[model samples]
Target: MTRIVVVTGGTSGIGRAIAERFAADQAEVFVTGRHADTVELTAKELGVHGVVCDATAPGQVSSLAARLERVDVLVNAAGGLPETASGDVAPLNALLAQWHSSLAQNLLTAVLTTAAVQDRLTSGSSVISIGSIGAERRGGSYGAAKAALAAWNASLSAELAPRGVTCNVISAGYIADTNFFRGQMSDERQRTLVEETHNKRPGTVDDIAQTTCFLASPGARHITGQAIHVNGGAFTTR
Candidate 1:
């Protein structure tokens, strides 16, 4: 059967890679992005369906969900660094704005989208949310929002697991070929990030994409409510 996969923020970066991977596997992939042009271009390039929807907006998220008939897999990859707003202010005000923006971008986006599509999910379906290693380190506002995502996933898993649905979070570290750094990454910083990993290399978009496919497969039915780290030994847990 052709699996129906829905991916938010699927126009670029990790989300784009994941969507392309599923499409390559012959899945009926549906992707969403904030821009009409990017969404249409990506959907055409990947041979999948695309919708223009901002995950941060409830009405848009609801409209996106309405477009889906049934979803076998839902990947909440619609998140990133919040846009800079109102500069040259007090340090406290700046920090507050950043925090609020991060919470909206990283946390609320997932919450709203997931909630909007929760009923459309079928048995044996899986929900995957993109998290960050920043939640475990000096992530500041971004980290806090990611941490909240994991925490929320725990409850969501418990709620959905009884119905044969699974939910989890993938906490990535130092992913390469993404617009994450906005082309501002220095060679020294890149080297330092690579050096911190025991594997001595940065993570790739393909790595995360493959992992996502596995997690959504039948073999991973027992895995739920867990934050699986894919940082190549950059951080370890007991």
Candidate 2:
């Protein structure tokens, strides 16, 4: 039977790629995004279902759960750097705002969405959340939130393991494509990131998508509650 997969933030970036990958594998893919247009368009493009959902909103998340018949895999990919609040605030206040936004965007989005959909998850289900290398170094509030995500996944994995559900976080490195840079990536910065990677290349959305598919496959049944790094050896912890 074809698996039923849900990908939050599936309209763009890693989430979009993951959804497409699952669809290509003949799975029934449902993707969620905050924007209705983008979500609908992406769903049409990938031949998957799309729902407009802001994972941070409790009511919406609850509704989303009710709308799903089943969720064999949940990819919590809705997260990003905090947007600058008010755009005109002082540096200190702006930083604080960014911190709160980061927590909301990265950590709470996953927590709320997963809690809302926990019941819909069936046996052998997998929950994959996108993480970042920033959580390890040169990271600020965004990293902190991702770190919290990883921590939460550990407990969640244990709680869901008896039911045959698995939880894992993909700690991605510098990935190209998507609006990740917000159109501000300088050539020098790109080169620096590439040089840091042992492979001398940046990561692609497909790289993450393939890994997510593998995690959800039966072959990964034994894996749970782990953070898999996919940064081309940019950061290593042995």
The best candidate by TM-score is: 1
Rate residue 196 of model 2 by lDDT. Answer: 96
List model 2 lDDT by residue over 108-138, tens digit each: 9999988988988889999999999998988
lDDT value, candidate 2, whole model: 0.93
Q: Write model 1 residue lDDT over 140-237, tens digit each, in one string.
A: 88999999999999999999999999999999999998998899999999999999999999999999999999999999999999999999999888
Top-lDDT candidate index: 1
Q: Provide the overall lDDT of each model, using Cα atoms, as 2-decimal numbers.
A: 0.94, 0.93
The C-alpha stretches of model 1 lying farther than 4 A from their native spots are none
